[model samples]
Target: MKADGEALVFYENGERVGTVPLAPLSRVFMRGDVTVSSSLLGKLGERGIGVVVLSGRKAVPTMLLGRPHNDAARRVAQYRLSLDPDFCLRFSRAIVEAKLRAQAAFLGERRESEPRSRYLLTLSLKRLSSSITAVDQQATIASLRGVEGAGAAAYFEGFADLLPERLHFCGRNRRPPRDPVNAVLSLGYTLLHAETVLALYGSGPTPSSASIMRSTSHANRWPVTWSSHCGWRSTSMH
Candidate 1:
């Protein structure tokens, strides 16, 4: 890719294929060995556009942040909030509750449509509802994670029932997703994470400030997927 004044031009086999205007762009995600010209990088940086590079089979991410937001006060407030355990617990609890409720609702819909899976879906719905009730009672992130984990297992129990037999999608798995269902889910999550990072940066607070759980490492990390909420996946990318 090369910068052409106000736009970026794309080439395939030495032939120009397309051009994209830079004016309306906020972020660019590049995967594998794609070549980007220095002039384009300069232009992107000048326009305060973020770039995310993904490499290797694991698709590890390297983020190139754009010019910082001017909302210093908001950023400072978010960082301070992140330090408060009580606040983080409350936020994390709310997130978990919302996720559980949504899962239950989805299962309820499927229960009606899939008579063969109704028994499994009913079991999941009951478990999810119980977890939602238990969310506020949990005082620590670790305990909260346990509740969420149980709920997720129940949720996926029903989820697996809804899938066609040929899919063989018994449960969620990743880190080189073993099955076709998991592979597609992983790809969707990776893309969602990139979009979420862009949205967070485009707003005010840094992605690190959005973290609800404490990391063992001193460095603050942002989750690469909503999988963290499911309690079965890694909380942050390495």
Candidate 2:
């Protein structure tokens, strides 16, 4: 990749392949054997554009934030708030409840369209509804996580029913993702995770340094790794 006046030009085997305008673009995602010139990177940084590199067969993401915010206090507050146990519990509960509700709603919608699949979808929706109630009643973050996990299992079971017969997807699988459907799902999740991290950084918080429902030891170690590699403070919890 190289800067060509107002556009970023892409090359393959010494031949020009494409050009993307710098204006109206906030970020760029590069994957697999892509070479970016220092001049183009500098230009992108000057224009406040973030760049994310997704590498390897699994598409692991590494993000480059445009510039650090001037407000140090906001980041400090975010760090402190993340350490509060009560706050973490409440935040986790809310996130889980919202996610489960959305899953139930999606299943409900699919049930309307696929009446033959109604039995499985309805069962999943009921499980999600129960999980939402359990999330609200939970006192500890660990129990809340358990509820979320159960709800996710039920939700994915129904999701498999929605896939076309050609896909042959029976359940969710990851890490290596044996089937094409699972591979696509894994890629989609990786992209979403990258986007979420970017959004968190843009909203004045470090993603690798904060923990919401994650174990304390893991949260503490993640920030160190992120900071070491990315030259930015890490905050993470999920």
Residue lDDT tens for model 1, 1-238:
9999999899988899999999999888899788899999999988989888877886767777777678989888987877788887887887787777777877888799999998888888888889889999998888987998888889888888888889889898988888877777776656657666666676776776544445534224674124234332322210
> Please, what are the lDDT tens digits per residue for candidate 2 over residues 1-238?
9999999999889999999899988889988888889999988888778898988987877887776556778889877977887877776676666677777777888899998899989888888888878887888877876897898889888888888878878887887797778888777665666666666666667766643435655345343232222211111101
Give the TM-score of each candidate.
Answer: 0.87, 0.87
TM-score of predicted structure 1: 0.87
Q: Which stretches of model 1 miss by more than 4 angstroms?
A: 216-220, 223-238
Give me the overall lDDT of model 2: 0.73
Give the Cα error of residue 14 in candidate 1, in Å.
Answer: 1.8
| CA lDDT, every model vs. true structure | 0.76, 0.73
Clashing pairs in 1: none
